[model samples]
Target: MISGEQRVDPELTTVIESVVGGTPCANSGEFHYSLAERRWEWSDDLARMFGYEPGTVRPTTELLLSHQHPDDRATGEAVIHRVEDGEPFCGRHRIIDTADRVREVIVIGDYESDDQGTVVGTTGFYIDLTDALEEERNDALDNVLPETIAARAPIEQAKGILALIYGLNSEQAFAVLKWRSQHTNTKLRALAARLVEEARQFDPNSPGARTRFDHVLLTVHELVDPAADAS
Candidate 1:
């Protein structure tokens, strides 16, 4: 039912379809209304964007806005309002994409007019910013994992050295280093850095690297953190 409170214009529907990504079927053509009486239709892409599909989704503007990142919501809402009021629409905002990935998108919307030139409906364009968002996510992960969690110091250096020589992932190399430290009775981080330095100085294919690593492991364990051997 087109509720008594709102009247949606028709051109907006076409705008959504044009911008929607068919493969992912995300918010391509849906517009929402704040007043309860408004009834509008949505394209499948739009349905998907708001976390719904062809059969089960309820179309609402609130649904669309709710997925917006807090930082982007205000600007997005204001732009939509200007379009609804017959003003030109333009903005960029961040939203949580269907994959729960925060993406930034460019928005451009406008309304249609009848022969009388009265505002009949509105349409909008959305361009995905998933790439930008993905970059942000990667940066955030690097900052958090390398700086906050994990064994803070030489664990990473050892991992890099192992990757440089043995062609192992950081996680795998770390497991090997930790296991070797436990066997030799040494502190994990210090033992890792010592292994890294030895690997840097000697080639693993030469066999002498192993002896050097062991020798340094013993010396560092004895000289640096003495309790490391006991632990």
Candidate 2:
């Protein structure tokens, strides 16, 4: 037993490790905040994810937020507050790794609470999408059949729109669109049409568009394949 007022399932830790180990372009870490002791616990992999040698740095909310990119720091703080407030948290953010590399990551965590429903801690995984993003940035679009060019025009248009709106490369944009299509039970061309139509209705710079864009990215995590994530 953990032998604390707040107990963690040792098996949950094991499952996290196993899933992360098998997952591509991803790593797992554990965080446990001792509310009473005001202390923090971190897994070695979590340390590495933040560019620390295992067992070297003491983990804290402040230290974690420090690794966030300047633009993402406020969002990181909000995530912490959500955890402290015992809300399930999910977000996309950027972190500066130990070597000063900027890594884009998706974080998903749920709060831990005592029987009395007081917040005890938060645990979750940080999945690195930097590799996929890089690949998207570097790879050229594949050759298309001349006969199929017209059929693919709307798709290409949608890809262009997504690329412009989300700062993704053409291939990455297409991948995201395809994922959304399959997950939503919509046909590819239909989804492509919907995306283009939706984009046309909003000024890209408008706050509503930005908000919807953020929500789209958040929901797209389900569409990301583990293998593609690492690539």
Candidate 3:
């Protein structure tokens, strides 16, 4: 029945008495939609992940929704509606914090009941996902092995040039280039595939002979801005 911007609930200072003495309150908000009287508390780590101030967040349901990605709005609302229907709920969404930076989160809640065990409320938790997201992304990046080592961008373009010039698969071309680097104890991407192309251009019978004489110039062109290459 919270039809507008009005909030009428117990002051957070009262019910959180257990931690009131020495608890470092960062950013927190209490919600009382019906009979549930609960306050959500976040640690300093959580606040940092959401980019919020330690003492200045109002922490309303609307604020949480505002942080969601536009595409996720309906899904998030549907989840909330389902939770209000008395089902145990777990959901993940993006949220913007006090600093206006976006963050990922998983919200979990269950039925709250009175002493008689009658269900009276539902309380939820917001767990920051910045660390988890970064870890997952890094893990995916790690799976690429050598391509990941070279940051993919440079190596992809370098692979394209090699595939075109040597009539070899990109993987095979990269492997040959890698073998050369390992034999010479040099960074694989340092010379890029242009060096290999130079070797291909002349002296096909020589082990390390190259003729392009401008490996540096071609490498610069291939490795710079792989994104624009897609364009």
Candidate closer to the true structure by TM-score (higher is better), 2 or 3: 2
Residue 133 lDDT in candidate 1: 43
Better of 2 and 3 by lDDT: 2
Model 1 agreement with the true structure over 1-231: per-residue lDDT tens digits? 223344444434333333332234443344433322343455455555545656585655676667788886787787656655655444557778567877666555445455796656654445453543455345444543464246556777665554333333344345445544543457786676565555567666785554354345334444445554445
Provide the global lDDT of candidate 3 against the true structure.
0.44
Residue-level lDDT for 133 in candidate 3: 52
Sort all candidates by lDDT, best to worst.
2, 1, 3
Residue 163 Cα positional deviation in candidate 3, in Å, after optimal superposition: 38
For candidate 3, lDDT tens digit of each residue in 16-102?
222122354332222333345433344343445456654556444565466666766875775556445544454556666657666
Give per-residue lDDT, candidate 2, residue 100: 95
How far residue 191's Cα lies from its native spot in candidate 2, in Å, is 22
User: Model 3, 177: alpha-carbon shift in Å?
Assistant: 47
Clash number for candidate 1: 9
| Candidate 1: stretches off by over 4 Å | 1-37, 97-99, 131-231
Ordered from best to worst TM-score, the candidate numbers read 2, 1, 3
- lDDT of every model, 2 decimals: 0.52, 0.60, 0.44
Say which candidate scores most in lDDT. Answer: 2
Summarize candidate 2's per-residue lDDT along 1-231 as a digit string, tens digits.
122444664444544544444453235465666656756676666777788887788877778777889988877777767655655565667899879989886565555667896777665556555766555434323322232255557577777765555445554455556645543445676566555556566677876565565454334444444453443
